[model samples]
Target: MAIRVTSEHDLIIEGGGMKIIDGRFGQPLYPSSPSTNHIVLLPENFLVSGTEQRISRRDFLSVLANVTRVMVRASYSTEPSAVYRLHSFSMQVANPSARGERRASAVEMCSCPPGYAGTSCEACIPGFRRVNGNLYNGVCEACHCHGHATQCHEVTGHCLDCSHHTTGPHCDTCLPGYYGNATRGSPADCQPCTCPLNLPSNNFSPTCHLGEEGELLCDQCQPGYTGPRCDRCSNGYYGKPVVPGGSCQPCDCHGNLDLSIPGSCDPSTGQCLRCRQGYGGAACDSCADGYYGDAITAKNCQPCQCHTNGSVYEVCNKETGQCPCKENVVGRQCDECMPNCWWDAERQECMPCHCSPHGSISQRCDVEGRCICRPGFVGRRCDLRRQGYERRETRRPVERVPIDTVQQRWGGPSRTGGCPRGAYRPKTGPLTHGITTGGQCVPCHCNSFGSKSFDCDETGQCRCQPGVTGPKCDRCSRGFFNFQEGGCTPCQCSHVGNNCDANTGQCICPPNAIGERCDRCAPNHWGHDITTGCKECGCSVIGSVTQQCNVNTGCCLCRDSFRGEKCNECQIGYRDFPQCTQCECNVSGSDSETCDMERGVCACADRTGKCSCKANVEGHNCGLL
Candidate 1:
């Protein structure tokens, strides 16, 4: 067997097992079990005798047999060949100088009990709990005081705070002064006691107890209370009870014995017993309706004067005769008219009517504002003037005569007698025979393009036809020409001309025209004709470089080769040439190199038949002999 020790008094045994056998034959010592294979323990107080402080085999067996109450001494000691095979064991101490403080001398099992430390459990350590078994055979654990306590009971592990309400080995139960649950896991479970409001302050019990189910339970009640709730007074009493066996007193009567009848006073509130006769109010000191004066003082009531037909009630106000008025009457006696009625001074009676200021004349209307209309007027409220009396101004009548009769009376229709060439008779009066008012012989103020004559019709208005206007019709109107024979013919100005003048009938030319009719070519233009409009000049760039040409004849003034009207075409003598070209005459014998442009004939210096030859040759037959 081998043994191990710790600083906390934990002992450990290791090996295959322990065996005891006979020495002579090497057989098992115990017959039933061949070998003893189990751990053994020794008491903490079992010690050795020498200065080395080690346990002997004899001493160890003796203590073991005594502790286990077994026959271990006989087997190991009697057998001469009995042998013990021990494994090695060693101990590591916290400090070698304090090796004496270690409990290594004691022998036990693998672990030590709580509060005991070192290999043999010989010493008790503070703040550790004994777990699993008694203090002799268990391990040491740190005591858990739940942070609220620093230490606890060594064996039972109860905390120690007197002021705390809970109780138990762990200080976890309700105390005498507190109530509610008092168990571990939760903190401060108990609460202070409070009695119900109906209980007297001095006589009430303040202590409470917790039931097994963790509910609060109160103590006994005071007097005059019966049930478990203790909220009500006992029987034979009406009001709240104050003392033990207490009962409420009866109410009193204030000299009016008739008012002391039953069913009047409330037992709890001590109010009136009953009211007598026609008295009302909480004290029964005032009078009732249909009677006047104080019922408590005078005691004799007087009647009121209210009109039977107009008053709403028989009873009236006590001081005044004012009663509830009817639908159409008011005042203290119920004798006056209502808001919509007026009193008539003469008739001495009330009448119902409404007169709006906008449509009536008086407050007390007779025929709905009896004068619906004023004097000499007829509509509502005298607002309209009467017919046949309307206001107007006087006007005189005018004398008239026919236009023909006025004409004949002035003179006659004859040229020497009647109105002049363009005149007619006046429409609204006798004709004035002369030109004093310009009334006689009124001209036909015709437009330029309106008419062909100056004589007006009988209405004294001028006559006008199309395209003419004026008093004499001598000129054209806006768009017409003034040609003499056609009278006022419509002007046919081309697109280049907008319109003709009224009197001259000439075209109002645009920028492209040079003549009054806009039919001529403009400056620096050529190739003008009636069929095509004027065109820009096309003078040759080399021959007539100026580009300007004659506007009337469309001819160019340049060299002979460039001879067309615009100087842009070649002449006869220079056919197919673009620029100026020299004539191709025989110049060796001719007077000039140029040729006739129309006939293509060359000029000669000899003055012969328009031909010249070399000097050594004969005339027409020079090439033959």
Candidate 2:
């Protein structure tokens, strides 16, 4: 056995030898150099007493020397010939202790390798990123273009654009009432299938067909119809064209028949077969005698011939036998009198008779008549008076007596005691023999002389004084003026008298002055007398005074200080005056004396001084002042 030493500089050692010459020196033994040969051993075969463990192939190759040779012997079992065998071999030594040990650093184990990940260098395929982590447990994710989804990339997920009826997330579903194609990246179009009009569409799916079992089915009359198919008419059929949808049937006889009677009219013929006897027409509006029907039927009644005894009621119609009569008569024939008349059933007469004299014949008769005669008349006919005849002697007049003696003869109060103050009596009868007279002594009227001896007629009618009239001489005669003493007097001018003619009031006003008391004047005249009482200057114009006339021009009389025939207006340059006396301006000094009428300015005595000017003018002498 040979032991060889290797040099650090030698990468591959063959037939290796070790001798301490230079750092790169080698020696052999026997067939090789002594030093080199001993260090570098090569032999056919060798046996040793020391125990040596077998080396593994991997360990032996690690320490094998370059160019080292060895020999091995094998026995042949053939008897043909004994063979001497020379076997050549090489020797390689390795350290078996190095087995099951690691040579890499801890940092290298912790770091990820290029294009790999995780502690074990396990990662996704190239060009792909881990979705979760750097181990086989992680998922490989891919990147995708905008708006497009990737099929192989889960980490980057999917990118997709919404299709026609689909949207959101994975684009997995359709919109309401819409359905899309099944596949992705396709057009994904949607279809809509709504039900027909007047029908209900069912389900949310958009691909539904019209007659599908679960879809909406529409068939039938809209409303107000019937029958198995909803197309027939109801009880009261109504429509047009006489079809199944024709209009409803109208009531028979319509408005012409009465609804109160169930069989009033025939439904098929629409005619009234028979009306109640009192009734007529389709509506049965006829009335019987003495009764009337309303608009509805003739059988319906109203009273007729409503008039009293003397009055007649006329029939309104013969068929209905209805009569509208006069207010005073009533009954079927108007034969009976109203309660106001006397009904005489015996004669069948209504009498106008009343109580006796003013009323009818019955003791309790209500009628009225005239009376026989008045109370004062006593003859059978109430025309003649009773007679009586007798004779009497006449008497002669007697002589007069002194009133004083007659007064004494009365022995009571004087006969004049009851007479008025001015009344008197005349003596005509004898006193010594006591007066004998055929006529009775008469009373007398009162006189102005205080005598009561004047005579009066048997009726006491007195003769009036010269100017008096009236039974009592209480009033004056016509044309007389005085009212006292009940006598007349001459009328005075310009004064009215009570006894004068009513048309003229007795005074008789003078010419130009006229009134009840001569207090007023006629037009164009003034004053109270023909001279002073009346000034008639013919001032015919209105607002004119007597002085303004040609006959009396006292001052060319002005009205409201306006002097003119017409009195049209005030004079020029003057205002507010009975006479044109207001000066145009105030005189300030002797220099300014009078106001100039034309210019309305003061005339100045000294031409140099200021002038008293009218309103609107100023300066010396008011020259343009």
Best by TM-score: 1
Q: If scored against the real structure, what TM-score would every candidate get?
A: 0.20, 0.17
Candidate 1 steric clashes: 38
- Candidate number of the best lDDT: 1
Query: Which sections of candidate 2 miss by over 4 Å?
Result: 1-415, 418-507, 510-524, 527-616, 619-623
Evaluate model 1: give its lDDT.
0.46
The RMSD (Cα, Å) of candidate 2 is: 46.9
- Clash counts per candidate, in order, are 38, 76
Write candidate 2's Cα lDDT for 287-340 as tens digits: 444455463432345555544443454544644543454444455555544544
Off by over 4 Å in 1: 1-39, 42-238, 241-323, 326-625
Q: Which ten residues in a row have the lowest lDDT in candidate 2?
A: 384-393
Q: Candidate 1, residues 1-625: lDDT per residue as tens digits? A: 2221111211322211222211121223333334433322432322332232445454454443334222222223233444443234433323323647455433344465555665446334665555554433456665554433445565666665523466555555666656665654345666665433323442233566655775545565344333333333322213344444333434342322242354454545555545455444465455446545565665543565566655788787764546777766778667666755644556544556443333234443331222222322322233333322432322521212234432343333424225665445455455476523424454445432233333566654455544555555555666776433213555557544337676665667644556767777776686555445577776677667476777766566776556666676665444445633433444344333344535644443222233434556444422321
